[model samples]
Target: MTQRRRGDLLVIGGSEKKDSDEERAILRQAARKALEEDGGRIVVLTVASMEPEPLAEIYQKAFGRLGVRQMEVLDIRNREQAYEPANVEKLAGASVLFFTGGDQLRITSQMGGSPLLERIFALHEEGAAIVGTSAGAAAMSETMLIGGPTNRSCLSTLAMAPGLGLLKGVIVDSHFTERGRFARLMGAVAQNPHNLGIGIDEDTAVLVSENDEELTVLGSGAVYVIDGRGIRFTSLSERHPERILTVHDARVHVLGRGDRYNLKERRPIVPSLERV
Candidate 1:
């Protein structure tokens, strides 16, 4: 059997700095690095946003300032355009494919099984870098967090939908700390204990390297990992549908800038500096 080739993924939290914000430079720096490593051409997908044009322009200018020579915005509004051969061809020769923040459902619903999405997966298999922000980030996992209440209660708080499936065994939530979404993520994990839950704070990101299955935290904020694999008990299924849910012994880890985690191992990899 042939082994499947995997591409790098940069899952950014919401509110990434576009203009001159030095404090949040890590997010853009990681993007620039991805571009430099692969072909310079970038294809920006704005299908998720309601106003694709403005979001496209914002990224165009921002990336232009970062010295990205070749870039184009593919604002695929409907299903007809999503499967267009001409539009799919635009993704050819592109080294980076970026999805901007908007409604995650727009991306999954419009382009879900389209030829354009197939082409993107092909390109990613061939080593193209894939980057997403906010809703885009949430849509990278196989199980997407569509909507949920950001409250302490876990009962019926999360609504899930299918995602792009770029990253498996994980569900990503953005604007984590800013929106106080820890409870929301816990609710998601409670429903689907098989997958890991990753909550990323605003202006933060996690760079997942396909080669080693390791994730490196970047930017100013933190990344929270919720592992429900060790859960000894749960009231999710037994509790009343309208009642609050509960779980015991769900392992949690907090990673700041420069911290790294091994996805396959499900543990933090100590930094070299710490050992020295």
Candidate 2:
């Protein structure tokens, strides 16, 4: 399945370091619409695990004042240059790749199944344009949240792990609603109730298309999306390790900043402002 689109991704939750003008005009209009649909390339800034002096010279000088005048900083956190497959084929010739925040277990313990994460999933299935923020959107979810104890009255270290699924059936949980994280994704979907729980917030972003789980949101915060299929969940069921849960019709969408949502018709759309 060669499913990927060459543009549109600006998952930010850390952009607003006062370079205002509405965050440099939404990072120069999503880097000029991903370089007008992938022709004017180069915007790779994985920063591996980050902190190479103010996050690679301050986000490569603020994405080179927003035109993204070429950038490449594959630090991959030195667990041996993140298991080189020629540095993931030079970050799969990035048309736009950014993952920087920190410690989603150091990116699934140094890029899981590394060949630079299978050439960043073969450069996002040969189309390019993948973005992440806040531990790179909590490790692009197939279950991930390696930091524990939110102390919102839940812990077993609130443990739920595994990630770098690059957005499959979802579970992303960034600095959601400014770190309350709604009981750590409501106890991580009550111990994984058929997955599909995101919590972005903190400048916000949700933007899905390939495989089109029909998400769409942007900056200035909010995106909860819980959707635990029906109300009859049993929290890891009998032989339970202390998780008795029940949620009837559990759905919560609280979007903002150009809202649109339809993760398989869970519905909400109607945005076309046209303000450039």
Which candidate leads in TM-score?
1
Runs in model 2 with CA error above 4 Å? 1-43, 47-66, 75-77, 80-97, 100-108, 111-135, 140-159, 162-187, 191-216, 219-224, 227-238, 241-245, 248-251, 254-276
lDDT of 2 by residue, 1-276 (tens): 854454444455544342665555435544553556544455444554546556767667776776566677777655567685677677645766777776677777777876777777777666666777777777788888666545354442366678887776778787776767676676677666677787887766776764555767777777877877664744444455454344446677777867878767666665666731
Looking at model 2, residue 254 earns an lDDT score of 76
The stretch of ten residues in a row with the least summed lDDT in candidate 1 is 26-35
In model 1, what is the error at residue 115, expressed in angstroms? Answer: 0.6
The estimated TM-scores of all candidates read: 0.93, 0.33
TM-score of 2: 0.33
Tens digits of lDDT, candidate 1, 1-276: 966566678899979877675774744654564457645788889999998888888888888777777888899899999888999999887778899999999999999999999999898887777899998899998999988776455675468899999988899999998988898898888777889999999889999885638999988899999999988877775447687777888999999988999999899887798544
* Clash totals, every prediction: 0, 3
Q: What C-alpha lDDT, on a 0 to 100 scale, does residue 20 get in candidate 1? A: 73
Backbone clash total for model 2 is 3
How much is 147 displaced in model 2, in angstroms? Answer: 16
